[model samples]
Target: MVTTPLAGPTDRPAPGRRRPVPRRRPSARARRRSAPLTLLTGLVLVYTLLPLVWLVINATKTQDGLFRSRGLGLDRDFALFDNIARTFTYSDGAYTRWLLNTLLYVVVGAGGATLLAALAGYGLAKFDFPGRRAVFAVVLGAVAVPGTALAVPTFLMFSRLGLTNTPWAIIVPSLVSPFGLYLMWTFARDAVPAEMLESARVDGAGELRTFFSVALPLLAPGTVTVLLFNVVATWNNYFLPLIMLKDPDWYPLTLGLDAWNKQAATAGGEAVFNLVITGSLLTIIPLIAVFLLLQRYWQSGLAAGSVKE
Candidate 1:
């Protein structure tokens, strides 16, 4: 084999000789742009996590520790387990009742809403009915209407029907989820192929069978998305429950926590403060559990949108 020396830019000693190229480093400007974004993201994460940190720390402390200790420091006397025990036993086990009520509301409301949304979405996407376009237009309009705006009218309507203070007031209203319907429509239209449905029909499957067997299986991602959205919304709900239900027995965790918070304000500073902190921590457990349990579905469901042909 013949040996060859690399040539410089100007020193071309032989035919077809090439100069060695140096690796280029990233510019200062590119480094600066990337560094700021990372720093900004770090700051944002700290800001978001700080409150959760405080809640965890405070909930572990006794009443004295809560008032006397450094905000982020652990209590010398940890009372977290004690507080949880007391919280469950408070007001004739009212917290447990509230938790059950919340579960009931979310299960019935979110579940029904998701089902209705999926059905409506499928109809709007695939079926050709006379008023289909107008129905979708109305749903779009309803999506823009904030729930806060409808609370008064909804309250009045429920009051006239003698439905106030009942679970139905909250559950019935939650069933109409315009956003879920919209999301399902978009998901069904894109995710479930028309050819699949046509083939099912040609195989002598009825509309109901096609939807349940073919379309619904394909709509798992959309259904999970809608379920999570409705669950979160219904879980954090305050105002509707506030106006509709006067009895504390009927209260969900949100309203129950608010009541505890108000009582905490007027009662001697220490006792009530401990109650509020402990209660707040307890209240969030179910929310976290639900999220963690359903998170796998949420992750998989979200990936559906990113698939390529």
Candidate 2:
């Protein structure tokens, strides 16, 4: 039997043909780099959420439990429903009226404000005319002027015009949001394309028609963001409503809740304490529901805004 000679060492595979080594795991320094940010986020979340937790716990307690028990502990009685019932029926169901008023104002005022702001922003961003930069600069300066600074002057002007103590006083002023305009401007600048507008024009579409047909859908994210901002601002507004409305019949929830809180400080009004707490908790439900419902739009809007030239 003839045996073939085995390949010699010279014919063997080169030793350098080893597999590539895996990458090293992240070192302790990388983890350390992320720790401070994590801690800061946790601190901020706690700071923002502590009051909500307190409200949730205390809202479930009865009038007696509110004063007698530890703030963090559950009460012997779950009086939330009872408190809500009294709150709705108290003083001929005034709290319900206040809630309705708030809803109306938010819908009309915030809704209109969003539409107008979107129109203004789209125009400012997409169209060019004389004094555009000056107009934008003025709007920026107006945003810098605090709402409080304008309150007194607005009150005086409304008083002179005999428009004070009316819904118009609150609704009209809310319609002009310089910040909303700026936000919409920034969003539209990045979201809407010039070529699309030109293409629509080339197809013989009028400006308004093009805006409604081609631009509005693209502007969905910006519009929703502006709408949510205006709604929250209008819903939680206190100072302006306080200055504008004197009659309890017209009071919004924020103002009405404050009044009830003050009343609870008195002797016979102590029972109102539970009502106030229950009402406060109930008021937040709509806001939470609205956020949950619109969060998808809000996220899309943010994504659109993140696109930069």
Task: List the candidates' TM-scores in order.
Answer: 0.85, 0.86
Task: Report, for every candidate in turn, its global Cα lDDT versus the true structure.
Answer: 0.87, 0.88
Q: Which residue pairs collide, candidate 1?
A: none
- Over 8-68, each residue of candidate 2 has an lDDT whose tens digit, in order, gives 9877777878656899999999979999999999999999998899888898888889988
Lowest lDDT 10-mer window, candidate 1?
298-307
Top lDDT hit: 2
Runs of candidate 2 with Cα error greater than 4 angstroms are 1-24, 265-271, 299-309
Model 1: residues with Cα > 4 Å off, grouped in runs: 1-32, 265-271, 299-309
